[model samples]
Target: DTAVSQTPKYLVTQMGNDKSIKCEQNLGHDTMYWYKQDSKKFLKIMFSYNNKELIINETVPNRFSPKSPDKAHLNLHINSLELGDSAVYFCASSQDADSPLHFGNGTRLTVT
Candidate 1:
């Protein structure tokens, strides 16, 4: 079974549209995160939640928001999407800050 999973593996939308990506982890991990991979393949952490509490919020735009209703789930919502928003969003989880991460396949977002 997959340790981490994300919905809508591929998403295509027009600029200014609002979109969301849902993620869940079954690894019984305490920390979950959202990372974005840019066109250059550089990955950056967007947000991190530990036990349903927000722990890390990176320097991303205000238009991008992460919501965690529970410890096992982390969802990302983007408003007023722009062409620059086209990238792969990955959901990951780890037992702790020093543990290895288990990542989902990723959700590719395309804005035209």
Candidate 2:
């Protein structure tokens, strides 16, 4: 079984389009997170959910939304996608905030 899984491993679309990526984990983790990896390979935390409570990083834009239905799932929604939004989105989970995160393969979104 996969510890973490994210759907649509690749996404290709034009600017202004809307898209969503789904994620699920079987590791029984308490905290799940969404991370964006930019072209330079910098991974930045966008949002984190602990037991269904949301914690958004201040630097993240409003266009990016993260929803966790339960402890095992976290989904990402992007509205009015921009060229700058093209990056690899990774879904990760950890037993707690201090534990190491196990990441999904990543969903690479490309905007034209």
Candidate 3:
């Protein structure tokens, strides 16, 4: 069983459209995170949710938001998606910030 899973492995949408990626982890971790891998393959942390509360929010745009209904799930919602938003969004979880992260296969988002 996959410890972490994300829906819609591939997402293709036009610019200005809004879309969301759903993620879930069954590892019973205390922390969950959202990472974005740009076209250059640089990975950056977007958000971190721990114990049902948002903990770390990087310098991400206001258009990007992370919503967590529970500890096991963290969803990313992007509004007015731009061409710059086209990238692979990965969902990850770990016991703590210092712990190794287990990442989902990642959702490839393409904005044209």
Candidate with the greatest lDDT versus the true structure:
1
Among residues 3 or more apart in sequence or in different chains, the pairs in candidate 3 whose N, CA or C atoms overlap within 3 Å are none
TM-score of each: 0.98, 0.96, 0.97
Instruction: Specify the poorest-scoring 10-residue window by lDDT in model 2.
Output: 52-61
List model 3 lDDT by residue over 1-112, tens digit each: 8999998899999999999999999999999999999989999999999977999999999999899999999999999999989999999999998899999999999999
lDDT ranking from best candidate downward: 1, 3, 2
Please, what is the whole-model Cα lDDT of each candidate in the order they appear? 0.96, 0.92, 0.95
Query: Which is better, 1 or 3, measured by TM-score?
Result: 1
The C-alpha RMSD in Å for every predicted model, in order, reads 0.6, 0.9, 0.7
Better of 1 and 2 by lDDT: 1
Cα lDDT of model 1 overall? 0.96
Q: Over 4 Å off in model 3, which ranges?
A: none
Better of 2 and 3 by lDDT: 3
What is the Cα-based TM-score of model 1?
A: 0.98
Which digits, one per residue and each the tens of the lDDT, describe model 1 over residues 23-68?
9999999999999999999999999999988899999999999999
